[model samples]
Target: MALDKKTIRLLILEDSQNEAERLVSLFRNAGRATRVHRVTSAEDLEASLGQIWDLLITAPSSAALDPTQAVSAIRRHAKDIPVIRLIEGNDSDAITEALALGAQDAVPQGEDERLVLIADRELANLEERRARRAAEVALREAEKRCQLLLDSSVDAIAYVHDGMHIYANRTYLELFGYDDVEELEGMPMIDLIASCDQVNFKEFLKNYQHQEGSAELVCGGVRADGGNFKARMHFSPAAYDGEPCIQVVIRTESDSAGLEEKLREISSQDLVTGLYNRNRFLEMLEPAVERAVNAGQEASLAYIRIDRFAGLQAELGLADADLLLSDLAQLLRARFGAQQPLARFADDVFTALLPGSPTAGAEGELRALLKQAEAHLFDIGGRTVQLTLSIGLAGLDEKTARAQDVIDRAHRCADEAGDGNALKRYDPADELAAAANRGSVVAMVRQALERNGFRLLFQPIISLRGDTYEHYEVLLRLLNPQGEEVPPTEFLAAAKEAGLAAKIDRWVLLNSIKLLAEHRTKGHNTRLFIHLSSASVQDPGLLPWLSVALKAARLPSDSLVLQLSEPDAIAYLKQAKVLAQGLEELHCKLAISQFGCALNPFSTLKHLNAGFVKVDGSYTQDLGRPENQEALKTLLASLHSQAILTIVPFVESASVLATLWQAGVNYIQGHYLQGPSQSMDYDFSPDE
Candidate 1:
């Protein structure tokens, strides 16, 4: 490396024969690279001074050497190069006088170290100045390139700092209804921001300073025209001619205009009908709820899934069905307008976000709208596609509830509406099913919990090799006020639909635990089978509850086998595996009910670790047929290979039981051995 990092050449002039020799030696020995010319006499000094040198070094006695005159003479030849003085002693006064002559610096004679030090220092200072200049040039060129790209960008671009619009590109100027970019310069970005969102935008600006990576961010924005959209902004600290500056990038909403047009083609929208697509309609509901709450507006989301859209689709085919949907969407849109955001929620379903519309208003509008929607017809593919809407409305109090909660409520209402002549409102019905449920059905379940309206009946699961049974499957039952028995099929489905499945499933497990404990205390070696739902498996709480319940019931885990329906078995496979593993730890057996019943194979069986599989009754009903018997035998062979015992369910007759046994089924369940009965109070034994 060059010890002297000077950007320009330098030369020193001195006049003393000794002092001039000293100056010459000092300049030569200087850590920096410099040229020195020494003159001994005043005439030689004057002669040398007459020549150009970056700085003049002469004997102090050269009185004719006017420091200013010497400097001015040197400048005449080298007008840009600055000069410095060399003093014979450490005379602050003399050095000050030389500096006043416009020389950049001065150093004393005999202080060779100090002179050399100043030379090195000046050289470094010169290099730094040059470097800064180079940097400035490069930045200017780069800035020009960046400006070209920013101006040409299709999206609008602008830089807003401290609320003021410091800069904007041509595109941004056009977006703001301006003819030139400078038009918006110096204008507060706050002026363009929507009044309602000004405060929010201000708060978000504070975030840019703390951000580490790029400071680029996205936010919802408003155009000068008051149109709303989203934009992504990029930012960085910069400088303009030494003035602090902020650089920015802005993109307009028009870029999405194409996608919006294409998406509208399938249009989550109906043409003849102005209804929204099922997916798009759902998307609209969330924001509607937010708007209702934030704006203190009343709103309701109605999911009017047409009752038999499939039947409608089948009758009309694509062309006419599409036309019908378009017509329906349009009709609903017309009826609701600003009051609701209307769309086709489904093939047959038309939905709307009813605003400022209370339940009573929504109910009446929906009822009247349903009549109009049903009346609307379309012709295509040579047929008229006709349909009626099933409207299920969920009242949304955006203030405290979530979008999903409102949706779930709407679906539940739709479910209860059945065949569609009626409209159901949410916010009621299953309330009583909860701890605070007040609905009639919920009240019924609550009564069962309190008045012993709950009961258990064991369905037989007999070993094929044994003349009697292996164990009895315990099923739960609830009695209504009429003393009518409600089977698991009835209430279980209802419980799940009502979102009370977990509540009922838990109750069954707890009660069964008590029964098993009581039976064990009686010296019974009965194997108790309990059925659980996929819903219960997801209750992370259920696993721990089972743990405590089993210990409290004082029943060996293996003595209690859990039977899961095929659908439930498949749906909760992972949790089922965990549950099975926990049970297996206690040597417990796992069984699947109504097995081989899924249209889709319950492939999860490979991982369930279950030990028993029961065939649905539909299979047993046809056992006399060779194909049926062969199917049964094939299933049994497969299950036997996996060590999964095969059991036949609903064995209505001895022939069915015999066929199942002959087919290699290892167990039998149903009336053939013993009908389902509350008599499960008796201990189950293989020899029963």
Candidate 2:
């Protein structure tokens, strides 16, 4: 036999010296990575326990010397290190038992790879487990930090889903007149939603949550005893207690607007440059367009797209990238005064609006910066990097007409054309199609309103039991100038996206009210309803304008019902709630235009004292389908039980009308009765 080394730290736990010396040879010849120690007896094991053993062996004669206990104690001291138990072929059972008991592996009288594989795999598993534990601990710490921040935030915060309150801040409790968070924990925020908004509050929240991860949900709420006020709310879903859930924060509208202005945090502020954020800047665009047109002043927008940004990101991690952006924002702020609004549009992109500044001068300055920036090196993590830019320009010429339009054109030019910091102006012919579209849309709308180019139709809403015409719904028609009629379904979306919904709503409301008031004065006992859009609700100026207009028309508030779309209102809930409240204070009867959009919490029904719920057309329009009819029946029954009037819209035929009547509909409106009219003089004569 071959002995590898003259001497080593070998005191094998064996009863025989011959077998112990043979096993010791393996360690002496073991690879440079190994440092092993061994003991040969139970007493020897105890004595060697004080020694740091990287590897241990059981000699053949020590089979009965409590090999299990000896190996177990060795494992406690060197959990990561391997132990090779020497075994004979006839002792497989004892070897298996010893290996299971804590010995890393059993190597037969000869050398084998199995022992090495076992040792390597076990060591790797131990390391992975340690890493996972560390990661889990870090995640826990992060979650705790987020929770602490949320709890102490000034905004009233909460989480609501499926009409259930899952989380809340103390500020939320105080806002709603609750004494403790515990009291409000399981209560729906809608429970305190003002009486005038109860009918659609849940619908609004559902809609708002679906708008951009989170939107500012503004609405009116009643204090514990019922005093009403407006609130600005934010709700976004985040993981809580390992479950995906919503997190909400609310600031009263007055306090929110005031606080925002004081903090100079307008909706979305470019945090780095401290300028109006992209969202607010976009909002300011339309006004800027109008201002330019009114003042006959020229304006241009330079959509600056960062080139080679991803390369920079790859070269410098996020922290260094952020620092680089901060530096760039500082340069922009210094170059463009605070009055010239600027924003960090995206991670690497920035935009600046130039007013009264010549396009050529702006071009010259940007060109100079581009040259400097291209050659300028960023030192990050001992690495140097450079960035380039691409610019697309749009001016207040025939090419780009509105703020969003200008932004899109500029972005298209920058993105589609060029390499580093190349400057290009918008091409009129390039955007002629879009311009033509705008002109066509505006002309179509003007024609609809001017030539009485639209139709006005009414659907009589009969009492459920009485089956008498108690009210009528005023519908719209978009038509060409030649009296060729256009369907509302065809143009409502275009009207909305084109930002003409509010004007259209105003026109419809004033006309509907005038007609309804006429019938009321003639002792006809008629009430007419018209729909309002979310855009109109967003405009706080609308309510007072409506009040003044209606008063001027001498229309009694109750005689003219105002219809509001559930989905639209829900998206702009806070605004919707406030607008509804204003209408209620004016004694205007309000109805949800599309109810049962989603499963709204019944708790939301406590506000709005809503007189009517227009069953969503999907549920009522196709009573021909059993599912549609059944859904309508269930909805009508549920609504009627709450003493809420149910109106079925889009009744195209008498058969559909009769089915709705049997299903307990409180009113009916649609094409089979009358198409929309162009003027308030539309007469819903029984004979017609």
Per-residue lDDT of candidate 2, residues 65-145 (tens digit)? 766666655543322334557676635444544544556666665554554445445445544544454454445445556
lDDT of 2: 0.65
Write the residue-wise lDDT of candidate 1 on 419-465 in tens digits: 76678876443433432232345566665654346787877666667
RMSD of model 2 against the true structure? 37.9
The segments of candidate 2 whose C-alpha lies over 4 angstroms from its true place after superposition are: 1-439, 446-455, 467-470, 481-490, 515-523, 601-604, 621-628, 656-658, 677-688
| Each prediction's RMSD to truth | 36.8, 37.9
